[model samples]
Target chain A: MFLFFLSSGMFLGWSLGANDASNVFGTAVGSRMLRFRTAAILCCVFVILGSVISGAGATHTLGKLGAVNAVAGAFVVAFSAAMSVYLMTLARYPVSTSQAIVGAIIGWNLFSGSPTDSNALSKIIITWIVCPILSGIIAVISYKVVSVFILKRKIHMFRLDEMTRYGLVLMGAFGAFALGANNIANVVGVFLPVSPFGYIELFGDFCVSPAQQLFFLGSLAISVGVITYSKRVMDTVGSGIFKLSPVMALVAVWAHSVVLFLFASQRLEQLLLDLGLPTLPLVPVSSSQAIVGAVVGMGLLKGRHNIRWRTVGGIAGSWVTTPIFACLISFICLFILQNVFQQTVYLP
Target chain B: MAFISIFKNRTGIESEIDSFLNLASESGLIFMQGIDAYLLNNLDSFSEHLSHIVETEKEADTLRRSIEDLLYRKTLIPESRGDVLELIERMDALLGRFKGVMFRIEIERPNINSQFHTGLKSLSNCVIEAVESATLSLRSYFKDISQASDHIHKVAFWETEADKASTSLQKAIFNNNELGLDLKMQLRDLVRSIDKIADHAEDLADTLAIYVIKRSL
Candidate 1:
């Protein structure tokens, strides 16, 4: 039973890698700043680093979302979420693994009679709404600031040019690192609860003990996903929406990272919410959404005419529909899998 | 008496020709470096420099063609002959783009609406670094190519930076409304072309580095 959950987590991690890694470096590749090979290699390295170093908080949130004691339930949720993301990716739609997983967990909770944590759900929903919008706004402002102040001066053209070039490289590198740090949990957080990391394991008799091991496996799976399946989606996302200039790409990425960090910061989210402001919890919202919002925001700052409404509409439609569709499919799958497998598959 | 005087004058003139050749060779390096600086700083003023460089490069091309003809007549060049010819051709093409990019900069100059100045500058600097490295490598007279490799890496670093700047610049451009839509599109295209110059330079540097490394190995 434990093995089933662990395997399901690995599949979820693979699907996450396939979908999310594209978000991290797609712009760079799309803009031809980095080659596909280079981006893939970088994604692999930084994602693993992100998973190992900064993946803990999200893992805990996922583990506590619902009861994981019923191994079959955990497996069903994991499998459903993975399949949803996979099918979406196959259809060339940029769906959010974070959203799918949360929805799946919610579906399971509904059937299990576990009271839904409205607070958690609200926070998650708020993040989903705000992250992209905020990221877009920040990208616009940052671009305006940098262009107006620093790039205009003509003091030693060669020296200034050199400085600007170096600065951009550093910025991209930082963005990549932040992406890894903030997103690792979304890929592998589910397995943290069932695994035995504490001195006395929570699921003592369960086969996979230590949540950290699950994270490690999850990270490995993500790496594999990044290497094998990320390119197709990366190519699609990188080139689909709009043609990006190097600076715009940087701004978009920077904005996405900043928003991810903001949501990922529990302390910050609480402070904002405490101030009577609508705040999003550190739920992993779609990086794709955050980037598109940032890109569009930057465009709006340019003017409404510059915004590609058609592309934006398409993306919005996907965001609105993907999770619900995934949930329904997973719910149906769960029913079917149970009926077919009968006693072989235990449903809690 | 007239024949003897003409003969003597011709001999004196022949002796002075070497000094002129030597002067031309020394001044050629200065001219190339000046062209690099002009392209890097005053990209908006590209046409003027491009014409001059194009004329000079044509002269070099003629000289190279003549040399090739002579080498072919003399018998096939030795073992390194193929490489030498290829190198010379590449060097000429590199100079040609310097001319072409300058012309392009001029053509795109009117659209320079201040938004892309930073990205343009960074890209120009990357080219300058690459050219400077190539110049240094050629003139060092020593066989050490590490110096050249170090400089090429710097160029690559700058190209990466240029890419970042362009992304931001484009974003800003997209946000700006004062510029007409046509002008904006033109500016975007121009910036892309300029960025490609750095990319080309980086390619050159990478190739040179590989050659140097392989030779060392």
Candidate 2:
């Protein structure tokens, strides 16, 4: 019964990998600089490593947003988020796992008659709008710095190409790692409330906790999605950020990584707080938003001609609607699962 | 659908640019043949080769336009798209010069003294060599960029030889009593025109060199 409830979490994880992972390496693969197979392999390795190592921090913030203690409640929440992602994908919108997970949490709260923490909810919402804007600002600065340093250096064309290729691979690895660290909360956050497996000693000294087991399984599902479905998404990603020079693409990815790491890294947050500096909120920010922001920043810096405003309008519209759609869907699904299906959704 | 098409999966745009280079090279071959027949006073063969050169130029033009369209329409390799476009346009201009020189030679049909035949033929060979070298350098830019400079230097060398050959031919035309003063000037213009073909080729080769450097560093 416990294993059965994990299905929805895995499904959500797969969807996150399928969509978000595409944005992670889309420019490199779509440009034919890096092959799809190579990008996918790198994504899988770094994303999994990121999930297992740095995944714990963001889950606490998600838990504070809403704790659906019942396994059945968690299942419905994951399912609702997955449905939202799928719907967004079909419409060709930039799907955000952070939006989906947060929406699902709100739905769980409303359905279980638990009070939603207004302060936590506000922080998440603010980050959603700020994340992309921050990404754009960082991208503009990075592009300017790199353009002055590398592009204007008058280096030989062949040498510039080799260097850009290497830079893309390095930024790609870092982006994948940042993505796994920040966004794994969208996969295994709900499952933390009612993890099925306790500590199991595989070797004499090696043991794993219930949360680790769930996260590892969730990470595997994300990997499967990257291996199977992310290719199509990656191709589309190339066209979204047009007129990007090699250095510009690298700057965009680097900006995105910085935004994600700032939000997701608990050690950084702790260091800030200890140094008498304000700590950034350890929230699971949207990778899609960050990357889009970076692209927009670069585009805007170049000129208005660089961006297709019609496309930008459409993507922005989708971002506004996704959370609302996901919240309503999850609420409706939880009500039906608890009342109509006679399943326990919330626990005392 | 348009958006999806823009993101359509494809391999290196360098290969597409290569196909255009190949077409340009074919027309270069046609240009060389037309001049060879022109020098031999074989009107029939010259006409045949000239017509073929014209046809190849038209085809090359069409290919170049199509490549430009594809580059603008698709978002593949946004980084290098501009460089590739510039390269093709330069090569396309060289093809036009090829056709122009051939057309001028056919219309004028200057009666050359056999004594100057060796100089003219040697000059024509040098021009062809420059064009060939330019095409080779561009090819190597795609396949093996490290080898690109070696081919580019050859283009420069042949261009220099062509300059010397044309200038020597001009001096000889003036010294000979067999040709009238007015005829000598006309023949001199023809020699200069032939040298321009090589000049155009060298210009393209120089552009390719800059592009190679831009991509590498």
Candidate 3:
């Protein structure tokens, strides 16, 4: 039973590598800034590190959200999420693993009396809506500030260019680290409760369980995703929206990272809402939407004419539709898998 | 004594290679610049220099090939060996294409018209800037990779600028009533070939930038 859950998590990790790993280094590869091999190495190392260090928050959310207590339940959620992502990749449609997992979690929850906290669900949903829009807005504002500085200071063109390129490489590194830390939860968070040894007893009964170990395993899965499957998506993201200048690329990455940090932090979430702002809780949002919003925002700083509406619309449409599509597909798949193989415990 | 012998022999070979590459860079730059001059002036002296430039380019190509073979033989690191060879081949190819354009100019000199000259010049200028940027980048290999950012930016900026320039030049050629149909057709083909030199240079710059970044040069 332990082996079943562990193996399922590994399989899901491999699928995530195939899907989401590309999000970290796709733009650099696509923009012809980094090669496939270099990007792969960077993605693999940093993603694993991110997962080990900061992957806990999202993993905790996923573990509790679908009531993935049993090994079988975790396996079902993993399998459903993996299938949805694989289908999306095959179709060459860029869909979010975060969205697919949410759908899968909901699909499984439906059978277990849907004990899902509406507040948690709402927070995740709001992140889906708000992350991209906020990122886009931030991207535009940042670009505008940078552009104004560039123009106003009348900085030497060569120096500006040099600074921009270095800044871009740095920003990309930060974004990659953030991605590893945050998204690893989605891959390995489900197996936490079933981990054999509960939380370790540090002082008294204060113990760390198999949850952390599972998170590490998930992080390893993401590292594999970076190594094996990330190049294609990196190429797509790097060159898909616009031919990014180094400055513009830096701005987009920084905006995306800021939004990611917001969702990943509990402290920041309360601080923003306390200021009379309608705030979205930190939920695992789509990195793709965040990046696209940043790119569009940067474009808008150049004016409406410069913004590639077609590309923006296409990305937006994918974000809006992918969850519903994934949910329907998984829900139907659950029914089929259950009826087709009656002896098999399809849903726990 | 053996160490001294080795040092003397090594230094002799190194200095010889240095002089050879220096000559190659100078001649390559001159040839590139001459291509620009020929397009702008359409002068007989520039055309004659273009012929000489082609001959020097052939010598540079031969030197580049020999160095590539030497680097491949001596380097212990398999990856770096391959990278160096690829870099030489690509850079040599840039010169080879410049020679090809010179050859075309030699052949088409008698029939070359003003529109041909205008479009070809703009395209040639783009190639010159790209090659010049690449050569400058090569000189600073030991410096921080960020040091080469200017070259990368120049390559990117000039490629876009060249595209805009070529579009206008082509428009001018097509819109002009003075040229004969045969000359117009020939000039259109010439413009495209010249434009490709810039495209190739951009590709070379991108490849080198990746190499620099990866190697932390």
TM-score of each: 0.57, 0.69, 0.58
Docking quality category of candidate 1 according to DockQ thresholds: incorrect
DockQ of 3: 0.04
Residue A217 local lDDT, model 1: 69
Per-model tally of clashing residue pairs: 16, 12, 10
| lDDT per residue as tens, model 3, B10-108 | 444344345444654665566656665665665776777776767777777777766665544432122344665676677778777777776787777
For residues B98-211, what per-residue lDDT tens digits would candidate 1 score against the true structure? 666556655555456554555556655555555555444432212233355666667677678767766766777778889888877876776666566557656666666655
What lDDT is reached at residue B2 by model 3? 30
Off by over 4 Å in 3: A56-60, A63-66, A151-165, A196-213, A273-280, A303-311, A332-348, B1-217
Interface RMSD of 2: 9.2
Best by lDDT: 2
TM-score of chain B of each: 0.65, 0.90, 0.79
lDDT per residue as tens, model 2, B1-217: 5223323323334445667778777877787777777778888998998888788778878878777776666544456768777877888888888788778877887888888888988888898889888888977776666677898999899999999999999999998987899889888988898899889888888888887776552
Tens-digit per-residue lDDT, A29-117, candidate 2: 75666668888898989988888787776544456787778878878888888888877766656678778777888988988888899
**Runs in model 2 lying further than 4 Å from the true structure:** A56-61, A192-210, A265-280, B1-193, B198-217
Instruction: Give candidate 1 regions above 4 Å deviation.
Output: A1-4, A60-65, A154-187, A192-212, A267-282, A303-308, A343-348, B1-55, B58-217
Q: Rank the candidates by lDDT, best first.
A: 2, 3, 1
**Residue A256 C-alpha lDDT in model 3:** 81
Q: What is the DockQ of each candidate?
A: 0.02, 0.11, 0.04
* Candidate 1 local Cα displacement, residue B163, angstroms: 40
